[model samples]
Target: MDVILFRFGNFPVTVLEAGLALGLFVVVAISVLLIVVLRQSRSRADAEIRASEHTHELEERISELLRTQSEMTGRMQTMAEVFGSRQSDMMRAVNERLDGMGQKLGQTMTDTTKHTNDGLRQLHERLAVIDRAQRTITDLSGQVVELQTILANKQTRGAFGQGRMEAIIQDALPATAFSFQQTLSTGVRPDCVVHLPNGAPPLVIDAKFPLEGYNLIRNAERPEEAKQAQAQFRRDVGKHVQDIRERYLIPGETQDTAFLFVPSESVFAEIHENFEDIIQKAHRARVVFVSPSLLLLSIQVVQSLLKDARMREQAHLIQAEVGKLMDDVNRLDERVRKLQTHFGQTSKDIDQILISTDKITKRGRNIEELDLGSLEELPSSERGNNQPTLLNPALKSVPAGE
Candidate 1:
């Protein structure tokens, strides 16, 4: 068993070499471990500085993105304002055009209404005038009907008959060529007298209208009354014929046949049909029953005769005037012959005077050879004053000129 111990210079000394060497080795390992820990701590501090620099770079990029977004929002706001202003101007122009069109439409509608109203007013006025004219025509028609009624009665029928007869006579002959109610020397007055030409006596025409009994017969109700009235009418016709024969048929005083005028055609036909014997009696009595148609024929015949007589008289007067005109023309021809004879004689006398003047003018051309200085004689008045001339020659035979 060996044991080791060390001893230092202090109090006790022992020798232990192995244990001392182990202690020295442990001190050296502890120093190397402390140096390695210091180097690891320095490397941790360098890594922390690099991480802080990276964090600062990220913050700068975020701030630049925010600035770009703000500039874009400002430009969009300016574009919106310009578009709103242009839209307002377009809306104002459209409103002004619509107002002008509305005014023109209103004026046109008002003018059309006024023209239609005026046309209707004129039509109403024309209708009123037509209505007034129709009323006037209706009133005139009523008056004409009343007047016709008054002219068809019995008591006033005589005046109407006279007027109708006068119209018929006037129509047959001109009233200016005829005289009515002319009285003759026999105290008989005729109804009409027609004057003729060439100093012929006027023709006498009597108007006798017998219509009383005829009217009674026309108005009879029963057949027996009609027969009785017809019989009375026959007697009345006969009496009227007799009366006309006595009043107007004066031989040599008036015409041979007297005119008995029946104004109505129906009355004349009745008298001829039922009273033929009365007409024969009238013919025997020199009374001619003349209807309006027959009277017109007779008047026309008389007028024709008068016209022929007038034409004949005019022809005679024209012949006499033609004979007188022929005499005047013969006298005018004789005066023209005498004037031509006087013109021939005057021409012969003028020719003889011209020949005598020519002979005198030729003899005067030789006056210078006849001693013209001594040929100057005294004046004729001095010679007459010197000698008294004999006032008268001896009155031989005593002719009238002498």
Candidate 2:
């Protein structure tokens, strides 16, 4: 539709002109839109092509990556096999080493156990020996204690000395040479009396000794106490010597000298060393203090004297035996001479028989050479002469044994 519009200052406007201008504006706008659309489509197509090329390069790169992955897998499998074999070898070596160590450990343990057992056994044996030694020591200590108890009593100690003296006398001398606990004619008992050879008087031996004073002297600690003990010992020994002289001595029944028997050598030595005056006084009194050894020596001397006396008593018998032996030897010599003479006569007879046998053999050979016809023609006397003599006339004259 056409319409009237307001006019500008210089031109008049109509509805038909407005319409034509409006249509021309619409047509130009449409042309510009179309051109913009075409340009946009071309840009889209380039973008699509570029996208496709990039995708193709990506595909090729992915394929190469897959091939590399497959190679790596194969190498990994080979490496795994190598590692497995090495592990197996290492396991075998470890097992072998462990077994060797175990065997060595077992042997070492066995040796240690054996050594330990042997050491224990040896220790037990040593302990047993020690136990035996300890028991022996205990027994010895008990015996020593008993001996000490016995020595403590005065009467038992005296008996002990007397017993020892008796043992010595019995061992050394014949029973006929000694007497024990003999009572003398004076109604006094002596411990022993040894009979002497060759009509000598019997010797008296007294065994009682003063041991208390000696023990006191030895046990004294102070010098003054020791001096007092020594003086007491001297007095006791002098009194003992005096008693022996007075009690045992007789005019003609006992020997002029008597023996005082000391049981201990230590006491004897102590007296001899420290109490010389007591020994001198005993000697003057004809009393001798004798220890065990000295008593044994005196007994041996007495035995020798007795043996000498026995030899003297048998001297005539031994000489008579020797004279008889000489007579027997002379008779044997005469018998041997007679046997030699008979042997000589037998030799002469044998010689004569051999001579006669030679003559007979010669005559027998002469008879064997004679002729039988000649012997038959001969006279009786000549025939007898020609015949062989079977027995020899000279052989008849020979002795019967020859």
Candidate 3:
């Protein structure tokens, strides 16, 4: 390596030269450093510019996001308001429907309760009526048992028959029209005697009927006992018929045709069915066997005959009343004729008065229709004159029918 030195005024030349060289070197180094620094500065400036551009892009993105968020928030608020309104409407509709259902259910329950009460009342009334009918049937059964016990005795049965005959006769005829337990010609006491009103013969009713043999036959368990009871019934009936014929068939006292009154219709039917020969014998003896119903019919016929006889006896009094009615009718007819004559005379007088009133009214109308203005046109002396020609002589002669 070669070394050189230089010197300048007031100092070493080599030093000055060295300084110059150093300055040169420094200048060169500075120029190099300036170039490196300028390159680094430009690089840094480029990096910073890229970073700022990136930051600017990010800020733009954030602003866009904020605007989008604001738009979304406003939309969400509107949707929430619409949803709340829809929810409120739905709740109100559901509440109204529930209220209506509740009211309808309440009314239906009340109506059903009332109907149940009415049905229960009607059922109670029907039960009460049925209970009353049950008691009535129980009492009727007891009465039937008592009646069966009473009819078991023969003497009591006879007395019962006699009493029934007396009651029936009294119901059919007046008390004076019938007699009970009357002795006949043969000393037989008949159950009933019916008096005829129109001079007819007395009717004798024998009520002593043989029911013991009939009852025995009815209650017989064996055929032989029933046959014997039937035979006894026939004998008893034959004897009773003979007695009726002997005692009641008096031609002068009672009717020639006598009645055998059996109080029980079942007993009379049994006799007719079982004892045909006895019925023939009774018929031959001029004795007619009559049941209670048949006897009542005969009594009704007797009562009607008696009523007809009584009406016949009062024929004179009825004729007298008819005569009095005819006299009253004739007197009323004469009075009506006199009243008609008076009406005719009054009508004639009213017609004459109406004719006179019509004539007076016509004359007064003619006098009122006279024109005073026309009369005033005449002389005043003529209006004041009382002469017939001065007043209106034409009104003095009115027509006859005016």
Residues 1-402, candidate 1: write the lDDT tens digits: 012234456644222233334445644554454454445545667755443443344234334433433443344344434445555666677777777778888888888888888988888898889889889888988976754453345445545555565676688666666777778777877777766555655666555565667767878999999988878877877887777777766666566667776666777787788778878998898877777788778778877877787789799899999999999999999999999999999999999999878756655553322432221264566465745432233222234331
Candidate 1 residue-wise lDDT at 246: 74
The superposed Cα distance between candidate 3 and the true structure at residue 163, in angstroms, equals 2.9
Q: How does residue 231 of candidate 2 score in lDDT?
A: 89
Distance from true location, Cα of 271 in model 3, Å: 4.6
Count of residue pairs whose backbone atoms collide, per candidate? 7, 0, 6
Off by over 4 Å in 3: 1-91, 217-232, 266-278, 315-402
**TM-score, per-candidate, Cα-based:** 0.46, 0.65, 0.55
lDDT of 2 by residue, 1-402 (tens): 223354768776554455455555645664564465556556788665554564455446545544654555555455556656777887799999999999999999999999999999999999999999999999999988886677778898898899989998999999999999899998999999999999999999999887878878888999999999998988998999999899999989999899999988988898899889999999999999999999999999999999999999899899999999999999999999999999999999999999989877866675565544545565677666745543335434534553
Task: Show pairs that collide, candidate 3.
Answer: 6-13, 6-14, 7-12, 7-13, 7-14, 8-13
The 10-residue segment with the lowest total lDDT in model 3: 1-10
The candidate scoring highest on lDDT is: 2
The full ranking of all candidates by lDDT, starting with the best, is 2, 3, 1
User: Mind giving the per-residue lDDT tens digits that candidate 3 earns over 1-402?
Assistant: 012244355655432344445556645764575466556656787676665665566456546655655565565555556656776887799999999999999999999999999999999999999999989989988987776665777787778778887777888898878888778767877778888987777898887787778878989999999999988988888898998888778888888888887878888887788688989999999999998898889999999988898899899899999999999999999999999999999999999999889888888888887744565577777778775353566675776545
- What does candidate 2 score in Cα RMSD to the true structure? 24.5
Model 3 / residue 160 / CA error / Å: 2.6
Q: lDDT score, residue 9, model 1? A: 64
